[model samples]
Target chain A: MFRYILRRILYMAVTLFIIATVSFFLMKMLPGSPLKAEDKLSEEQREIVLEKYGLNDPVPVQYVRYIGGLVKGDLGISFTFDNTPVTKILMDRIGPSAQLGAQALLIGTFLGILLGLIAAISHNGALDYTSTILAVLGTSIPSFVFAGLLQRYLAVEWELFPVALWGTFEHTILPTVALMIFPMATAARFTRTEMIEVMGSNFITTARAKGVSEYGIIFKHGLRNALIPLVTVMGPMAVSLMTGTLVIEKIFAVPGIGEQFVTSVMVNDYPTIMGTTLLFAFLFVLIILVIDLLYVLIDPRIRLTGGES
Target chain B: MSKLLEVKDLKVSFNTYNGEVQAVRGVTFDLNKGETLAIVGESGSGKSVTSMALMQLLPKPHGYVKSGEILFEGEDIVKKSTRDMQKIRGKDISMVFQDPMSSLNPTMKIGNQIMEGLIKHQNMNRTNARKKAVELLELVGIPHPETRLNQYPHQFSGGMRQRVVVAIALACNPKILIADEPTTALDVTIQAQILELMKDIQKETDSAIIFITHDLGVVANVADRVAVMYAGKIVEIGTTDDIFYNAKHPYTWGLLGSMPTLDSDEEELFAIPGSPPDLLNPPKGDAFAPRNEFALEIDTVMEPPMFKVSDTHYAATWLLHEDAPKIEPPESVQRRMQGFSNTGSKDGEK
Candidate 1:
């Protein structure tokens, strides 16, 4: 198990390094320079700004320089954001995104599982139909659309909560709810399918024959097995949600890393763009490893031997 | 012996997309205390449906007991609510299903599976239940009960998993243990060992067993009385000595002929001539008529009634009627039946 984990960490490092390299080249492929974003800057000032950041250097030399900076744990200064360190800027903006994403994930997942369990247990009943319809709506309609609907209904019309922008907990509610839709849909779909299959399994019948209460059968036997696949789907979904709430952040006017990423890319802020891409890659690979380790934890049959690597 | 369970005119049906399939059509049988009664039949013969009806475990919204009275200890289980059945199940009547591979929760410890009934029905504390679980595992002949208790079902072999299944069924000391083809999914040697363990456990616990299987050979070793089911009905039911030695129904002969006796030098194994009738459009008369080589003219027109062979034996066949032409069982069937008198003492004497 230890060897397997070591191997996975190594793979994660390689994956992040590849993402960093690729995104650096991709950012360089952009047409406009960061200095162009400053329309008011004089031609001489622009040249000085360009020289100050070593914009005249060859692509290979810049790539080597970036690699050296990475080795020293430096995600160089952002070109567009007053030459601020990309890492510090990202750190400052991470708070709101994390809070919103975490809230959506926890509540959405819990409710989704609850809904899925109800749908599976009741089978083809009204509750099942309703949950299925809700899942369909959540999946088909994007989060920004949900953002629009929540804003109009809750904040503007009913006065239930704030319409937009991040300030208090009330302001966080609409954006969190909008962001929650996709995860909720994915979780519900997986849970419903898995629970239905598990409920029909021979072990469930044996549990029933053993006089296990319906509550016990659904929660203990059915849900436990169903949870395995749910986690498998949720792990990757969690990484995406944690790292990329860009559009929802834009709609809600939240100062999140996703919003910064979009702005940095638009203005050709190479350092911030690469840092964000690398961060997303790190999270994706790390979560994949966590999911694999979790399989070993939840299922007794999946023993991660040293030979697995 | 006293009656432990009485299933009268028990009918089970499944409402499919096509229509209702009468899976178990008006079946009747009785189980006596400390006795093992084996119900033998082909697939879709309704033996499994009958057993599922006993536990009310039939698939809901699709399969259900159409009509029947399952009187266990004089209480009609047919009328019991889901909640009510929960109390009776796993406590008074537990089940051991076929395929031990899938019969246990793969994620759970076998010990906890065995302890669930003790905790639920007996209200035993965790410590007491854990202790009893170890004892139950040992009772089922599983080696190293203390260590095995903590292990998951996948960690055990197929035979050992079946042993754990039996341990779970016997956890609450149920009065009736309904074993639905318990040995069907096991190897031949393991089947014999499991049968032996069950017989030994019966001696120890005296729990009545409803053994459902298609294997006549298994029936001979474990059953006190044998009930041959055909097209969701019992065509022949008699004491083990009577069924094995003086079997009457053509279906019974067909079943017996299929068994490979160690000494018999038969070149080809006998299989029933045709598949069982589809229950969605079940034949109006004898459902086995198409498959029976000796099916009489009347068998095509009318279902035969249960005709008494002796005080303890009965057969649903026109051959047992006075008007039906006289015919003997086929040569291979007779060869198999001839040796039964000396070798068929299965501890289930009526």
Candidate 2:
């Protein structure tokens, strides 16, 4: 198990390195330079800016310098926004995005699992059909569209909560629900299908024959076994939701990292963009590692031997 | 011995897209205390369905007990509610399924799986249940009762897993034990060992066993009485000696003849001809008339009632009628019966 974890950590490092390199080259390859308004600067000023950031050097040299900066925990400076240190900007905005994303994730996951369990246990009944229809609607409609609808109706028309922005619990409701729809739907569909299959499995029949109560049979045997596949996707889903808040945050006018990242990309803020990309990659790898560790806890059959899960 | 379980006029059917498939049609039998009653038949003959029906574990919204009364100790189990059935299951009666690999919960530990029944039905405390679980495992011939308890199902071999499943079923000391082809998925040697273990366990537990299988060879060794099922009906039922020595039904003769023996020198094995009839549109008269070489004209026109061969033996065939021509069992069947008795007498000499 120790060997397996060590190997996974090594792989994670390699993956992040490759991601950093690819994104760096891809950003450099884009049509315009980071100096968007070079015509506004004097020739000497442009030279000074370019030389200071090592942009005048060869691509390989710049790449080596970037790696050095990363090793020293120094993400250079934003090209836009008065050349703010990229790390400071990220730290400032991360709190809001993490809060919104975590809230949506918890609410979405809990409701999805509960609804799926209900649908599966009362299979082919009215509740099952209702949940199936709700899942379809949730998946088909985009979060922005759902956000628009909720803002228009629940806030503007119904006056139940504030229309936009973030502070109070009521303000978070609309955007959170909008952000939650896709994941909730995905989780619901997965849980319903897996729960149905597991409930019908032969082991479940054996449990019933062993006189396990319906509650024990459904929760202990059915739901626990069904959660394996669901857990596999949950890591990616959580990260995706956090990253996917860009459009939702803009619509809600929430001052989050997603909004900052989008603004940085639009204004050609090289350091901020690269820093956020690395942060996303790091989070992705970290969540996947945590998920791999969790598999050993969830299932007894899956043993961590050498490098195999 | 008193009757432990009596299934009367039991009929089971499945409502499919095609039509209502009559799986088991008016099957009737009784199991005595501490006796092993083997229900033998070909695939799709509803032997397993009958056993599932006995436990009220048939798949719902498709499969159901259409008409029946499963009387256990004089109480009609058919009338019991799901709640009542839940209490009865794993307490008064328990089932061991065919595939041991799929029968056990993969996520659960062996000890916990065995302890579930004791905790639920017997209401034993965790510590006592744990100790009893080890004893049950030891009872089923598993070694290292204490340490093996912590291991999961995948850690065990196929035979050992099956032994764990048996231990789970026998944990509560159920009044009736339904072993539905418990050794079907095992190797020949493991099969024999499992059969022996079951016999030993039965002697200790004194529980009536409804052994469902297609193998006559297995039936011979484990069963005290045998019921020959054909197309969801018991065509022949008798004590082991009556079925093996004084067998009367043609289907029974076909079954006994098909079994290979050490003395047999036939070029090809004798297989019972034709497939079982489709239950969706079951034959109007006798379901086995087309396959029975000894089938009479009346066999095609009407289903024959059970005819008494002796005090303890009965067969459902027109050949047993007083009006029909007197006919003896086939030469090969007689030879197999002689073989069984000769071996039996030798064992008695020992």
- After best superposition, candidate 1 residue B282: deviation in angstroms? 1.5
Clashes of 1: 0
Span of 10 residues, lowest total lDDT, candidate 1 chain B: B341-350
Question: With candidate 1 superimposed using the best TM-score fit, by how many Å does residue B180's alpha carbon deviate from the native?
Answer: 0.9
TM-score of each: 0.97, 0.97
Give every candidate's TM-score on chain A. 0.94, 0.93
lDDT of 2 by residue, A1-309 (tens): 888889899999899889999999887776666786779999999899889777899988888898889888988887776768888888988887888898888899888888888999889999999999999998788888998998899999999989888788777888889999878887888899999999888899899999998999998889989989998989978887876698899889888888888888886777888999998889889889888888989898887779554
Interface RMSD of each: 0.5, 0.7
Pairs that collide in candidate 1 are none
Q: Candidates' DockQ values?
A: 0.89, 0.83
Cα misplacement distance, residue B78 of candidate 2 (Å)? 0.9
